[model samples]
Target: MKRIFALFILLSAVFLTACGEDEGNAGSSGEKDTINFGATAGPYSDMVTQAIAPLLEEKGYEVTNKEFTDYVQPNKALANGDLDANLFQHKIYLDSFAEENNLELSEVIIVPTAPMGIYSNKYEDIDSVEKGSTMGVPNDPTNLARALIVLEDEGLVKINEDVDPLRASLADIEDNPKSLDFVEVEAGQLPRLVDSEDLAAVPGNYALAAKMDLLDALALEDMPDDYRNRVVVNTEDIDAPYVKDIKEVIESDEFEEIIDEEFQGFGKPKWMEEE
Candidate 1:
């Protein structure tokens, strides 16, 4: 009987250990818990909280959004394990940011973004800008190309047609009819300085956040499908089931409602427009 009692205790110990492990992992991969995501502290934050979070919770994820004031911290948090994912940037900004920082970050799904444009507080139109006027463009490669393309389209400048628009830069400008002085500026700073500069190329996100008029743009780009806003996750996590769930949530009808209601000035989805 003593031997039988000892065997019972042994079996009970194994059962208890298994139960402990199951409980410990309950809210992790086995089930969904709080997913800590990051975004810039405006439309991105509002959209995630109002749209993405509710959808995620329906699939069993408790969503928590971390809002940052600038572009740098969201990626940094994602890279450092402080965030599970981020949704503030498009593929172009992500590619440049990831490459320069050596983070193997990649996109999961595309979302609508504010269409990019050149806005001037001083000039009523692009035609009014005098020669030698100094215009501010984003210093980053992707946005700089966008600004250059808009200028090129407006007949103020000529870019080497041989260069892909995605990869074009100041160096690709083959002609400058206005002899406009192109100044490289930080993207976040563009909205505030539009009044001071001859003209400034601004991203839709920042402009919307700053309450600038998207309709008042002197020139706006046709947002290529490649530049659409996307949710980014570390490459290692790209194949994770939770990441797939996040992608599903973003593409759901619930999110579509939020897009229609909240993003009136954000321009149309790039997919809706043809090349």
Candidate 2:
């Protein structure tokens, strides 16, 4: 009986030690050496692999990149301590997702993000858009607001003065000078509709995924800094040692050189533009 009891205690100690090691690797546990990052598959993931990871590796950290295929999982992973940081969503999205899900995520820095634009096969330029023409926009709330604001910027439509621009919808349009007919389409499908619709408002990420050039748009969005993608971390780890390292690398001159060389056509944040 004494021997069996001693073995059970030994096994419990081993199990607890293993659990602690796993927690340390999760990043929020204050681990400073091995850091994990999450991003959507494509440009943002490429950004981590080609630009950020090398710099962090040079600083003696082991960096791992996890590519998520959907918008939902990255934040879910980040919130549950699966990722040290993530770089796929903008400030507005970060704020909304955190509030809705009761997650404590925060941004470390905004990165150059692809801007949504008005793409049309029927019209060569914004001026050429005829009256009563139909246009495609994202069905999602945030991006729909963004597309409407872009249309307003181009003098195509006007949103109601009292509505929050981030939550604007087709019903919020106070005036449509062109008498434009609007169609709400799933964001991923908007790119394909460019050949069919009079004009389609394609978000920058989807446009790139569809192999459309940012320069091909009739008018690109004059995006506010809130719409730009950012590096996100758990609120608790905002001031972690590894988080500081990641921020310094992004703000480095070497980082700008990489973005300029590899990420042309992405919209710059105000801080980046000011520099």
Candidate 3:
């Protein structure tokens, strides 16, 4: 009986030692070392996964990019601590989204802007647009305002000076010499409307998806010094380390190269150098 008890104690000690080592190894590997990111599904998000994430991994951050379809959920997830960062919206859109949803998110970095363009199968140039011609614009407030701004810039229409970009509408059009009929449609459907309407203002991503070339467009949004293209993070995490690393990766040359190549010069890197 003494010998059996001694043998049992020895086996127990060996088993405990092995279990302790295994637990230590798991603790080291299972610790939270990955930066969880979110982005809308598109070339932009794919670029983040392909170019940006690899660069971050070299710097010791494990990047897990979560893809989202709609705009609001990504910000909400970031604000609620479900994500470390998101790279799918500009400052103007982000500000408007936060205001309408009552969320407190902040801009951490400026990404590329998919320049909004006016496309027309009927006309080759903005000047060719006839009076009383129908024009399609996005119905969403954010994109509607953006489309209006593009029109105003092209001298097609004049927006009211007192109206904010967030709230501008057809009513704000103080001058419309062309008397163009404005047809408001869903932003995603704007490109399709080009076939029916005389002209339509479509966002760059949608235009690309619809296989429309930028050169084919009547006009594109100007990339001026005041252009507001950006990525956003939760206000509480604006200064976080992982978020900073994300900004650096996005601003890196690798990301710039991807933008220039994949977008065929349509998407320029505005964050790094002045255009």
Candidate 2: residue pairs that collide? none
Better of 2 and 3 by lDDT: 2
Order by lDDT, highest first: 2, 1, 3
**Candidate with better lDDT, 1 vs 2:** 2
> Runs in model 3 with CA error above 4 Å?
1-32, 96-104, 223-229, 265-271
Error of 2 at 36 (Å): 0.8
What TM-scores do the predictions have? 0.76, 0.85, 0.78
Model 3 scores worst on lDDT over the 10 consecutive residues at 24-33
Off by over 4 Å in 1: 1-29, 69-73, 96-104, 122-134, 177-184, 267-275
Cα error, residue 122 of model 2, in Å, equals 2.4
Ranking by TM-score: 2, 3, 1
| Candidate 1 deviation (Cα RMSD) | 4.1
Candidate 1, residues 16-103, lDDT tens digits: the string is 9788657723543465366888988888888788889889989877789999987899999999988989988877679889999999
- What CA RMSD would candidate 3 show? 4.5
